[model samples]
Target chain A: MKILLSQSLMAYLSEPWPWYVSGGLIAIIMVLLLFSGKNFGVSATMRAGCSALGAGKINDFFHFDWKKAQGWNLLFIVGALIGGWIASTLLNDPEPLALGSRTAEHIKSLGLSLPKESKEIASGFLPAEFSKPEFVFSFKGILLMVLGGFFVGFGTRYAGGCTSGHAISGLSDLQPASLIAVIGFFIGGIAMTYFLLPLFYKQILFPLINELQNSFPK
Target chain B: MTKAEVISWYRIQEMFLFENFHMYGVIGTAVFLGLISVQLIKRFKAKDIDGNEIKFEPKVFSIPRYLFGGTIFGLGWAMTGACPGPMYTLVGHGYWSMLIVIAAALFGTFVYGIIRKKLPH
Candidate 1:
């Protein structure tokens, strides 16, 4: 019986599951959370952590009974981490990420390498550019990392939740705030992809990477 | 594996770029199930492990709050292509770059904690 279970598990993990199955599972997990009188969110863990680590001494926002209110939230995140471990280590497939052709071309044009049409199932989840120490230590990398991190952290706090918080829990509760937040998220996303991203790459990121100012498109 | 959950965000990115519809299907189905599950949980008056009644309070709203916050968050999302949950997944996948992102994010959170009193909730 155990052998049969492991075999099925491998089969399920080998390929992507259909959407409904994943969606239904997410709903079920949310239900379990709600039934236990808990709100589900990923960003809230920061608040809980800050409070636990004595940041309450500095700001009233961190001053709370986090162990009682947010202890479970922390546990949930740990579970997510463990689940991530299982996903990457055990269930991982050697398939190259199936990025869209246009997107693939755009990234390639940026001088980032990806799996070409020939072969070589991408060994890792991201392109090799992301894993390189030189990329991480680059000036462009520093700006993107710092600014990107700050924006995600501060914005989630300012918005009272992140994507999972608003899109899932807030929307499940039928809140106007979540609806507005979700809309704003899409708008921000659109702005970034269409305008800021290309411009940043051309003006600063790409130029800084190659040290070639003439690479800018006319 | 739940790595697909991590991939789903980029699927949204892909959708915005006019690539595909699978992410929409995933979100649609999840949200649909979410609505139903929330209603059922409320109707049944489900209890917790501690035997407390489960409830969802109505959330507060402000026009500018979500607009500004979400837009900022979206930019970061675009920058990283993954949010908090997936950040860990990236680490699990052995990408050292994500640690840099996560560290900066924690520092951001700490700064927020310091100034949170001044921010409008």
Candidate 2:
């Protein structure tokens, strides 16, 4: 009987929970944040960290009393990191991760190759072609990482939030700015996928890959 | 785990628009909306512990700034699958390379602080 119970528990942990379950949990957290008179966001934590590091002396933007206003946000991010560790390790799914067929086909259509086996797909969450040391150390990878990081950091601050802050929290509060920002996020995503991405792969990334291969002769 | 895999997910779902098409995203959004609505109602109609009316003012609204900021943010999101929040998650999941993005993002914020005075409201 004990063995059977253990098996069932393991099974439950191995499967992904239905969408509503996770969603409900997020809702509960948001309500708690609202009652506490705190805004929900991650980017604000960066500002708080900057202030804590004494960035306020140089600029008014980071000059606030971060301990009083954003202490909770700092704790919140720590909690998220801890929570993620627990989820990924303790409650990790035993089965291989799988992508939707349409997603895989679309990637292939973009001139990228995917591993055939389910186990390979699962372990290859970041494909080797891009995530491998050679690729990351290459000029193309460095540029993408640096440029992309700048855009995300600057953009989130300028916009006043990110996917979680604006789309989930701000939209929940029915803020007009969040709504506008969310729409902008969608348009930008579509443009990148259809326009910028293709051009990038064809002109820059592909050439880099070829050059690297030639230099190594592997 | 990798940037390419992350980008593929974006193509399938189109960022936060997943709420419009996926059950998980919708459920999450609905939950937030419900809770936020209740909070708004309480702020307007209910009293605090000391019988004082809660004064919750909405954030400042600026159309042009939001549009510009949001467009740039969207472009960034497209380039990187992990946002500020998920970047932490990625690190926790053992993708330490995400630290590069996080570092760069913080630097970007620092630059913004230096130049914010010059940007129009």
Per-residue alpha-carbon lDDT of candidate 1 for residues A1-218, written as tens digits (9 for 90 to 100)? 99999999897776666777776777777777776777778888877777887888987888999999988888877777677667766776666556788877665655556644323322445556666778778776677777887788877777888867888778877889998888877787778877787788888776575666557664
What digit string (tens of lDDT, one per residue) describes model 2 on residues B20-106? 234335445554665566677566775444455544457688876677777777776766666777667656655556677777788
> What alpha-carbon RMSD in Å does predicted model 1 have with respect to the real structure?
3.6
The local distance difference test score of model 2 is 0.65
Superposed by TM-score, candidate 2 places the C-alpha of residue A116 at a distance from the truth, in angstroms, of: 7.1
lDDT of 1 at B56: 82
Which 10 residues in a row give candidate 1 chain A its minimum summed lDDT? A115-124
For each candidate, the alpha-carbon lDDT, in order, equals 0.72, 0.65
Q: Residue-pair clashes per candidate, as listed?
A: 0, 1
Residue-wise lDDT of candidate 2 within A1-218, one digit each (tens)? 99999989977854655445556666666666655666567888878877888889989899999998999888887776665565557665555435556556555655644544323322433344444566566665566566777777887888888866887777776778888877777777667666776678888778887897899956
True contacts kept of each: 0.58, 0.47
Task: List candidate 1 stretches off by more than 4 Å.
Answer: A1-8, A115-123, A207-218, B5-12, B117-121
Docking quality class, candidate 2? acceptable
